[model samples]
Target: MKNILVLCTGNSCRSQMAHGYLNTFSQGKAKIYSAGIETHGLNPGAVSIMKEDHIDISNHTSNHVDEYENIDFDYIITVCDHANENCPYIPSKNAVRLHHNFFDPSKVVGSDSEIHNAFLKARNEIRSYFQAFVNEKL
Candidate 1:
């Protein structure tokens, strides 16, 4: 099975969503993990948004990239520009690196409906991207 790592500035939102979608899409064909340049705990918005799509990430923890240094990953995907630009080097001999700057829904400051929409938008985009990733690469 392929081991995949999704990276983000904070493992709170976007990467968490991607991890959930990829896990669903891969269907035990691949192992999915997510971490951040810095841990910010799981975002409640992310958990709630994913629950809408029937993916639970509430039990997921915000991990630092350094925690998985010993595991050999097949793919390293950065879901935000900050992580792509600033992520620490992981010693993987054959990991393929990919990047996509997903919008940060946690940064949205507005009404409840607007905030929910933002999270929904990010979740959908992540779902679409990882669906393609699994179809083509997993």
Candidate 2:
């Protein structure tokens, strides 16, 4: 199976959402992993929002990129600008790197509806992007 890594500033929201969508889109044809420059812990909003879309990421953990230093990844994807800009070197000889800055729902400070909308928007964008990634690249 092809191995993919989704990286972000934190292992909390955008990366986690992308991980979920990528896993679904790849349909067992790929192995998916996600990590952060710093572990911010899995965001609750991410879990809830994913659940709304019938994906479960509540069991996912916030991980540091250093934890996967030994695995040779096929593709390394950064889901946010911060992670893309500041990402540490990963020693994957042939890994194809990709970057897309998904909106951070956790940063949307407002009423409940606004927060929910933010998460939903990010989730939808992630789904669309990864589906295309799987179709084109995986």
Candidate 3:
């Protein structure tokens, strides 16, 4: 199976979402992992939004990129600008690095509905992106 890594500034949200989608879309063809430059813990908003789409990320944990240094990855995808620009080098012999700056819903400040919508928006965008990534690459 191909090994894939989804990375972000915080493993709490965007990377977690992409990890979930990649697992679902890739079926058993790939192993999906996610980590952050720094662990911020899993975002509850991300869990709730993903659950709405029938993907459960509630069991996912925030992880630091250092945790997976021993594995040879086929792909390394960064889901936020900060992580992409500042990510430490990983010694994957042939890992294809990809990046997308997804909007952070946790940073949005607004009414309940607005905040939820923000999560929904991010979730949808993440879903679309990773689904295509799996289809095209896996």
**In candidate 2, what are the lDDT values of residues 13-60, reduced to their tens digit?**
999999998888899999999999999999999999999989999999
Residues 34-53, model 1: lDDT tens digits: 99999999999999999999
List, in order, the clash count of every candidate structure: 0, 0, 0
Question: Which pairs of residues collide in model 1?
Answer: none
| Predicted candidate 3 versus true structure: per-residue lDDT over 1-138, tens digit per residue | 999999999899999999989989998999999999999999999999999999999999999999999999999999999999999999999999999999999999999999999999999999999888878887
lDDT of all predictions: 0.95, 0.94, 0.94
Report the Cα lDDT for residue 39, model 3. Answer: 98
What's the true lDDT of residue 10 in model 2? 87
Off-target runs (Cα >4 Å) in candidate 1 are: none
Could you give the C-alpha RMSD of every candidate to the true structure, in order shown? 0.5, 0.6, 0.5
Please give the range of 10 consecutive residues that has the lowest summed lDDT in model 2.
18-27
After superposition of all CA atoms, the RMSD between model 2 and the true structure is 0.6
Which ranges of candidate 3 are over 4 A from the true structure?
A: none
Considering every candidate listed, which one attains the maximal lDDT? 1
